[model samples]
Target chain A: MYSYSDFDEAFVRSRVAQFTDQVARRLDGSLSEDEFRPLRLMNGLYLQLHAYMLRVAIPYGTLSPRQMRQLAFIADTWDKGYGHFTTRQNIQFNWPKLPDAPAILGALADVEMHAIQTSGNTVRNVTADHFAGATADEIDDPRPYAELLRQWSTDHPEFQFLPRKFKIAITGSPVTAP
Target chain B: MTKAHDIGLRMVRNAGGEPGFEVIVGGGLGRTPMIGTTVRDFLPVADLLPYVEAVLSVYNTLGRRDNKYKARIKITVHETGKAEISRMIEDRFAELRPLFGGGDQAVLADIRTAFAPPAFRDAPVAAHDAFYRADPVFRSWADTNLAAHRNAQYAIVTISLKAHGQTPGDATSDQMRIIADLAERYGHSDLRISHEQNVILPHVHKSDLPVLHAALVKAGLGTANVGLLSDIIACPGMDYCALATARSIPVAQELATHFEALKLEHDIGPLKIKISGCINACGHHHVGHIGILGLDRAGVENYQITLGGDGTETAVIGEKTGPGFAYDEIVPAIERILRAYLALRTDPGETFLQAYRRVGLGPFKTALYGEIGQKDAA
Candidate 1:
């Protein structure tokens, strides 16, 4: 797994700080639910059918063991004792509280992961075939390219207001008959 | 990759043997399912960023904004027509290509270094062979959950989250930690989550698989049902998603439990059962060999079945069978179809899709709808 560069670390920390403020404002009744909706969603928070769901991005479906342990920690401490991994290679904590959102983001930052661009009509998680770098059939590791795209698209200013969520997938290997 | 993604890139070596992409644009699944069109037959690796930028730019400028349902790039491609879309993308790519200035390549080069293949150890696999010969349970899990690795000494183990009757993709905190531990100890600290909603230990030494399997079994992560009937793809339907009209998780659980009770999942062979709560297709039901769409028809949970949908390199949309089944009736309906397939297939080797493609939907339709075709003829 690629370790986060200093710039990457700083960027996530800055976003977490910003979101902490946003969440506090929303909880204190200053920002209306309507007002706070997009703010929450921009950070991958969703007010679901029963409770709040926080989706954390696992860029290109790659996770270091340290990161996985952190996710497990978040699942155990904050939300329910489980997490649902989505089709896009992201994980969703189905029962997060609005007040605890920033704290959860902080824990994720400790492991160099975040929920940025995971929701709200932005360029979403850039996914690739799970077998990248490990499969013999691969012509090249697509993770590097997927990582490049993930960096380019994360919090991309222009893409935040797109008509719908945009998705991009890359596969380094040819598909065989399933 | 499934052709249902918004942009699907298949890596291919051109005739001259240089690596590049066969870029397919505008494929999506929701209310509408489309297999993406191949806009560029062969896009050089150097052009990937710029070309993708061009496609996005074209979409941003021209894609429908009036209707939420039609706002996807798939609809944009459909409305614009492929040739015009291709031409527009090409024109945009030509204009945007130079702006990149190869900076992306430098970053990619650096990223590539991080992903270098792990050091595989040459260890004796005598124990692995012995276990394979001795333990039937270990052998079944090994055959079902493991994939051949680039290094012969290594095997890619798919840790099945689809333990019988469990929510398809939910991993308990304890299971997550167990998987993390396995990855760190035996899997070179590499873990992958498949789109099919399973965790993968991508590089486990074959010699270490038995121990890993025992740990996984202890954690209740060992069902040995990867790519089997019980290995379903189900979305968080009405249970979680506000947009859902019906529940998907319970249906998946019931189906898995039903098939497991029959003790027939392994014999049923590689059957994909994808269930979506609504038309959003989050579960990728359209691609399942046995696709089930749960709909709230007049306040009742009605399930619709689609047969022969495939999500491979040769992707095809599934065909819907006759009338929908009630929530309670769906499982039995499915059993009938599978039983019909078992009886109709020429051999056990013939998969559900192969049998469907060869014999067509008539037999399965009759099985599900109870010989309605003959009744209508009569």
Candidate 2:
């Protein structure tokens, strides 16, 4: 439901282009695997057992129909015909090729989505009660603040690197309610 | 916070028109699983940030750094004890309290303003009832997927991602689109991703349930198995996760298919079977009613069972059920446990948990290993 501003769009597009160049460099032997590892991880790319896995963020688990259709298109075009929705509310493409990573990210950017902070030591996606606005017992919806937290934490200088990966979850419901 | 060090903090607005939080410290699951201890019954909401700072500071400074496994805050709490941690946090809170001049209230007010619920409309319930009566499939789906909403004309619908025999917590791109469309048209544009790996349409009008269900059915997303055995929670084990020692998805798929074919899922009532690839408990096997933890025993996939674990308000870690079973033997082992439960239960009204609690694990163990014991004796 949250649309990206021009700045946000520019930021993501630039990152995609940057990663595409990096992938090319890695393929051409200009950058070693060790050099490219952290860069790829920051973009939510992982070398899993069988193939490269790409995790795309579904911010606070909210998506419009347009975004959903775009994701469907990505699944059909790039990876397998389906995507695995993770426990964290993100989607994982298990069979992505290294060369297609940039294209996948560019497609995500078209829908105001990204894989940034879905991996690496920085704060992962900020999760909240999926029933934030709809629950009967909740004092308030927690997503607006979750969105605020997301904006604040995304690429924040202070938390760029940490001793461990951090996760934050918000729920407006009382302890006994859920 | 429950997994890491720091604390599992729960905040609620009290009758006195102020928010307060209950702090639980030291709870974690892995090799050394422990439920958090309640260190503070309640702390003023205003002091939350400062208190959290204090807790994190303690963990950051003193938590284990040498061994990656032992670095979580839970281990630190285990080493130092809750009382000592509480004292340290309280002392730090006192020092930090003066810095916060009640600015949190304004920020909280702004946040509350942003989260206001949408305007609800009065809708005729007769339309929903008529649809329910006309379509048996719709009726069954409504019975399982729908929950009571605050508004009389509204219902909360849970879109179960765990379709029978499919990978748990996976939604196809088309399924996702259908859910999105339903949310926009009927659910006030609100969708929720449950921790149990399901999509939720939080505020749908009762009048719209029929059309929504029809759309979901068309998309292959309508699975009337919420909280059923088929609605299993499983992690991507050996098939996907590099850290996995055994396959969790295939085991879940097999069990789901097996149970569905037997048609015993609905009769069994609400049962949570969580499967983890390993001891990390990513599938939350520690808290499942029937917890299955996969392990590699001598190059063979072995699944160990844990009974009586619950993740609700009355949380309890599951107890192990002797030696682990091989990959093929796991499903039959589960069937044996369920059969024993069906035989032992007082009535259909008694759930698996109730029966398990009433009779304890002795009979279930007998059901699982009884024939093997007799065979060995012979």
Candidate 3:
């Protein structure tokens, strides 16, 4: 599993600070639903049928035991006692409160995980085979390339405002690709 | 090979202990989902990264951005044709190849030198049998849900999500935590997501099956069903998709309710009913044994059913059973089709698909819409 560097850590910390202020503004009527919608969406918060859903990225679906334990904690503490594993190799909390979401995002950042690019019309999470390194027929695990895409796509200036959400799934071979 | 004193790569096996790398691009599900075009039939290990770069650049320059529905790589290949796409990719690939591929054969040799399957202690042959004797649910799940491993001592386990009438492809976050823990403890920390929207632990030793089953059940990720009728793939229809003409999830829920009510899934053998909101085939209705596509009839949501579709090594698009059925009448329509398959089947051994393919979709059409005016035809 990849650990976050100091720069990555600082980036997430600032994001949390920004979102916290944003949430407070929304509550006090400074930010309307229209104003708060894109801000929250950029952070991977979705307003689903039942409640607000938070999609936390599990990059390439790889998690350390400690990170796994933190996910269990989130499920137990904030939302329902479970998380849905998406086809994109990410996880979603179906019933997150609007206010607790920043705290939830904070908890994930503590473990080097975040909800960045999990939603929005921008490039979404870059997915790879869950069994990348351990697979029988891979020429090489595609995660390194997937990671490269994740870095390149994040807040990309030109491709950021495309007409639709962009998704990229990288697999080393055709037979096991999808 | 960066030889580690006790470190090693686990589980890489094919004939002659090697399989060449291949690549596909632009495969996705949505309104226009299609199997990705084969971009690389064989990529030598030395050129892996650069080839992928070339593929992405081609897509970045040429992929559509005007229509949200047509923005996927599949649509790019569809519009330009695979040959043209490949030609452009080749030109880009040539420019990038020399930069990455030159004198990298040693790295290639180093990579292959380290990969191998895990070695496990032989457990008693009767272990699974002993567990089966104690738990019937475990027995049924293991029988249908597990895939045969090339290494006889291990099995690929599937944690089914298709509990009768629940949302498919969904696992609560706690389920994710537990599954990750289970993978580390029992499955060598490797997880897999099956095409059918379920998770897999790829390398479970036979001895650990009993404990793993218990933990899975506790977390509510355990269901004995694998390929039975209840394990459906449904597209998110009018609920979220702007393109859908009808609802797929509710229809899937109803079918699941009907089959589970009858408790006839096992007796009927394996059946897959994939539901799509439109002809784009996101739910993969075209490749299902019994496929349902939600459409519109006079501005009202309706369903178009197809039979004998398959998505295995022998993939085929299904033929339609009839014109279409009203939203309220679709569930009963499917029931009629299943009953017809049961009656027309020559043996219990024949699956619904086998019978449908053998007798053709005409019989199913008659059973489903024999009462409709103008005589519904397959």
RMSD of each: 1.4, 3.2, 6.4
* Cα lDDT tens digits for candidate 2, B1-378: 222223555556767867666666666666677777777777775566666556656666677768877866667777899889888878877887787576655555555565567788886899788988999989988888887787878989998888887999887777767777787899887777776788888889899999888888788789899888888888889998898999999999999999989989989988989999998877878888899999998899999999998765467888887888999999999999999999989999899988999998888888888957634423
Report, for every candidate in turn, its global Cα lDDT versus the true structure: 0.89, 0.79, 0.71
Which has the greatest lDDT?
1
Restricting to chain A, the TM-score for each candidate equals 0.97, 0.96, 0.95
List, residue by residue over A76-141, the lDDT tens digit for candidate 1.
899989999988888999999888999999999999999998887778898888878888788888
Clashes of each: 0, 1, 8
DockQ of each: 0.79, 0.43, 0.27
Model 3, span B153-185: residue lDDT tens: 777788887777777777665676788889889
lDDT of 2: 0.79
Give the least accurate 10-residue stretch of model 1 chain B, judged by summed lDDT: B369-378
DockQ for the candidate 2 complex?
A: 0.43
Residue B34 Cα positional deviation in candidate 3, in Å, after optimal superposition: 3.4
Residue B274 C-alpha lDDT in model 2? 90
Binned by DockQ into CAPRI classes (incorrect, acceptable, medium, high), candidate 1 is medium
